[model samples]
Structures are given as C-alpha cells and as structure tokens.
Target: MTTRRTFMKGLAGGLAFCSCGMLDAASAQHHAPRRLPVMVSGKRIRTVDVHAHCLFHESLELMGDAVARILPPTKGQQEHFIVVENRLRSMDAMGIDMQVLSINPYWYGKDRDLSAKIVQINNEKLAELCASHPDRFAAFASLSLHHPDLAVQELEDAIKKKGLKGAAIGANVGGVDFANPKFHPVLAKAEELGATLFIHPYRLGELASRFKGNGWLANVVGNPLDTTIALQKLIFEGVLDKFPKLKVLSAHGGGYLPSYAPRSDHACFVSPQNCDPTIQLKKKPTEYLNQLYFDSLVFTPEALRHLVAQVGASQIMLGTDQPIPWEEHPVDHVFATESLNDSQKAAILGKNAAHLLDLKFS
Candidate 1:
C-alpha cells in the first residue's frame, strides 16, 4: 500500500519537476511549500483539524463593556479571534483543509437569560462563519452546560436550527464533573441527537497557588491533568457504560489517560479492595480507552505513536491547538511520524474526523 507520507513525497517530487521546467524563481518559491493534493482509495484526503479555537466576538459585544473589561485580550488574541483573513492564511500555510472551531464556555456563571443570549449569539455567529466559508470551517456549539436543562435546549437549537456540528463543553462546570448523575440527561440528549461532544478543560482553579509564580503550568500541566481526571471519572462512574454510543472527543491527546491506562487496569486487579465495588463497569479501565476519540496534540512523534498504539488509528484525529502554537505544523507532524503507515496517517490526518463530523467533499 502506498502510504500517505510516501504518496505526498512522490507528489511533491512531481510538482518540483514540473515547476523546475515551467516556472520562474519567484513563482516556484510562491508555490514551493503549498501542499499537493493527496488521494487515498480514490478519494481526496483532506486535513480536518478537530481542536481549533475562535473567540466569540459578537457574543462578547453583546455582553457589553463590563464583561469585556474582565476578559481582556491576550497578545495576538485580536487577530486570532476577530481576523478571519489571517486565520485562513495560517490554515493554508499549514495544509489544514478545514478547522472545527470551538469557543470555550465562559458564561457558566451568568444569569439564565443572559447566558441564553450568549449561547444564541455564539451559535448564530458560528453558523454564519461556517456558512460563509464552507470549505474552511465548521463549529461546535457553545452551551451553558452548567445549567443542564438550558444546555439541552441550547444544544438542540445549535444542531437542529443553526446546523452546528455539536457542542463544546468544559470538563467540569463549577467543579461538577461529567460523571455526576445530574449531567446524564444532557449526555443522553447528546446521544439521542447523535452530536459529537467535545470536552475541553477549564482553567485548573485547584492549582492557583502552585501556578501563581510563572511558567503558566496552570494551563500547561493543569489542562491535560484536569482532562485526564474528568475522563477517568466518566469511565469509572459508568457514564461510558450508560451511553455506549456517545461520540466524545477528548482534547490534549486524551490528557495522559490513554498513555497511562495500564495503571488504571492494574489498580482494579492489584487491589480489588481499594477499588469502588459499587461503580461496576462492563470492562476493564483500559478497554474503554479505544471507545473514545483523541487528538494528536502531544507535541512529539513518540507521544503520538504511543497514543495510537493504545487507542488505535481510527480513534485518533488531527488536532492542532491552533493560533496558540501548541502543535503548529499539524500535517507535518503526522507525516513525519515514522511509526505510522500511510493508511494510519491518512486516517489521523482527515478520514477519522470526516467520518466523525459527517463531512462530505466533492
């Protein structure tokens, strides 16, 4: 089988050969780094990013000056959020054919009416962006999941009325983890709707003291650590067992869980008395690892390889925590990973996400 990386290298060679005879120096340079079209099994392979973000500018404007004051922009935040042109350029340069844009929930604390407005505005703007640039973007809905009832309605509106892909939720809302039985209705609704539930981490509030000095470990270590714990809670608490078909995508490479799942499997076996007997699950902890989808944002090829080994190729998708410089060259990252074959590379780069999002390309 012609692997995706080999096929791309072959395509690049052909492009170089043709450009050498036909184009001038500047023209060749202009097209030099542009990604050549890739095909696998007679279908064009696109690079669909599962972990990209955009700030809700219109929603913020609706929130007015007071809320904006507290949520002041970070460096390059304006261009990253408000400026679509720059975003497109960056995508093209990185060979990302489409981005699944999501905005982290910041309205969890707002009043019901105000929070509803925020969800409405965010969904509408996201729908508009996807409509305007069909090829470049699709978005996950921003829901006030803290209010499960409202979140159910908001999710329905986003998918049914606004045509969103799904909802982006924080791992925990006001310190309430998803494993809590109270959140089951929302999870059931998502499964009923067949919507992909993306779980991103909120700020690690528990580590405020440790992260006070510098280095932003709160975001670095805290983000994945929080996600790991949240996912484990869901698994051990039998949330996965309850909603077997739930298509959950965990950000930050499943936040150290997949890589360290053996520990979990051992915990139950090594010390059955130490484990919770009431929270019985159908399978071992490691068995649920492959049931979830993860992004390739671990920053190194070895880490990605380990994740794939643990979770399988079809469960891993291309995710560049874009505009944040976490995993900048997403396509390059997948292609350069020697551990993966062409089919695995193709699946991670786009096929898995295309199936997950139900994206059809001509």
Candidate 2:
C-alpha cells in the first residue's frame, strides 16, 4: 500500500460497492416480505380462530340418526356432516394457524348419563386429534354439567390427565342456571385448577320457548340473549365475585351484556335485594366486562368495533363458530376493519389467543 489512509479508503469503497451489489442481488431474488393474508393491520400476522367447532367422526356417527330424524326428509340434513371437513379446509385456505375446537353445546341434552357418555367419547376423539395434529388443533373439553360431581371428576381427568386446554359449558345445563349453587363445586374446581371455561348456549329450554315456532328463532335470537342472561346471573349472583381466578369466556361477543350493562347496574341500584347479596363488585356492570373475553364473531364491522371499544383490543379473541350454519369469517372481518391499527389487530387475531392457550409460535 502506498499510504495507510489512501489504501483504507480504497478498500472501504470496494467493500461498499460489494455490499450494494449483494443487496441488489438479494432484492432481485426476493420480493418485499408479504403481509399475512388477513390481519387487522397490513402486516405479517398469524391468526388463531378460538371459537371453531369440530365434529368428531364418532360424534357424527352417534348423532347421525338423530340428525336425520330432525331434518326435513326432502332436503336431507345428512349432508351437513361435510360441514366439518369443509371448515377444516377453509381454515387452511385462509391461513389460519390454529383452531380451538369445541362441540356445540346443543348436543348436550337433559339426559345426564347420555350426556356423560357423549362428552367422554367426544373428548377422547378431540384429544386424539390434538395429538395427531399437534400443530393445527387444540380443544376445550365438554363437560356433563347435568351431573356436577361427575363433571368435576371429568374436569380433573380432562385437564390433569388428558391435557385439555380448558372446558366448555353451556349457558344453562339441564335447566339449572350456571350461577345456581348446584354448579358451585364445578366452578370452584375450575377456578382452583386455573381452567378456562368457554360458555355456549343450548338450543332448547324455557328460554328457547320464549322465541316460539321453529327452534331457529330461539337459536338466532335467544342464544345470544341466553348468554347475556347467564353471564349477568354469574356476575350479579356472585359467581365471578367469589371466584376471581375463573377464566370465563362468553361466546358471540358476550351477547347483549356489553351493550346494555348499564340497565343492570341501574336496576341493582334501585333494588339491591333483587341482586344477589353475595356479589361484591366494586364497579358498574360494564366495568366487570373486561374481566371476561369475547370472540370476534359479531358479524359486522360496526358491531366488532363497538365490542373492541367496550372490551378493549386485548380481551377480544378471534372466533369463527366453524362448521355451523351461522359461522362468519372472523379473520377477514378483522383484517377488513380499518378502525384498529396493526398491533391491536394482531392481538385480537392471534396474540391474545396464543397467550390464553399458552402456545408458542415457531
């Protein structure tokens, strides 16, 4: 080298040129990182659909005759079994990373023994599926709330032995409200065990009869109404107050409670005796809404926006209610909403769910 500075500068210039050339080569070979196909923000985000249903082959086999008996002989509801496979395919097509499956609560009838058998069979298959497709499926175990002791035993076996993520219970089980004292043991067990209880609505009962005519009216309108009533019963009746550790998730965006919680508080203020004395909620009815989580299956962007605002983005998890006639595209719905930023959307779509399920993204 003639001089150190001159040689160093020359070498630096050559290295810079080489680096630029490499950058150009890399740019030519690769496109800018594509955003995840569906996200609240146009960034690469993985999504988890929390409120998906998966019909086990055995469940379908058990219910096949029942399904046929219920359906119109002309149209044939037997074909509905395809809905399960179709839902799984749709999740794959939409880039949904994981689906937390639960059998719809309607199948849990008034028969305690039959319900227990059904739950055991369904959960066994669900556990098997999770084992086989460790990457794709997780599940919430269904319990036979018709028998509280049996349910508690099942909960222990499911969570401690079978390794289920959580348990799914209906808004009302065998005509007993979730807030009823009869269910206290189950709730206590769930809370003590740190289990997530996903509450869904059953199709028939006194509440369903209120809708009249076809049960579809009850399912469409009364289902969400039942959810609201059940949750309020839990809150006002002191179930939540007593068991703060219980992780209760209300389906269909927590029904109408998020929107009309003020009425409940006002009623309580007017007549404290009407509400359960055991509850010691320090805030308004709406305030406790944050304690529960909601799924993003509200159907419209406006409804979702309101729900997100009420519950905040972190408490909102993605739910599709897959394999059901009323299922919606929660991933696309979240992505299409312009109200939320990248981070908020990411939390709702998958991050929140991942945290809840204690999953690791590879």
Q: Which candidate number has the best TM-score?
A: 1
CA lDDT of each prediction against the hidden true structure: 0.79, 0.71
lDDT minimum window of 10 residues, candidate 1: 15-24
How close to the true structure is residue 231 of candidate 2, measured as C-alpha lDDT?
A: 90
Local accuracy of candidate 1 as per-residue lDDT tens digits, 63-96: 5434433232333333335457778777776678
Positional deviation of residue 189's Cα in model 1 after best superposition, in angstroms: 0.8
Report the lDDT tens digits of candidate 2 across residue range 111-215: 766767778897898888777766678889988787888899989888888778889888887667889998899999998888889988764466545687865
Model 2: lDDT equals 0.71
Best by lDDT: 1
Give every collision pair in model 1.
3-342, 4-342
Q: Which stretches of candidate 2 lie over 4 Å from their true place?
A: 1-43, 57-87, 106-113, 207-210, 213-215, 325-327
Score every model by TM-score. Answer: 0.86, 0.80
Q: Model 1 misses residue 184 by how many Å?
A: 0.8
- Model 1 lDDT, residue 86, Cα: 70
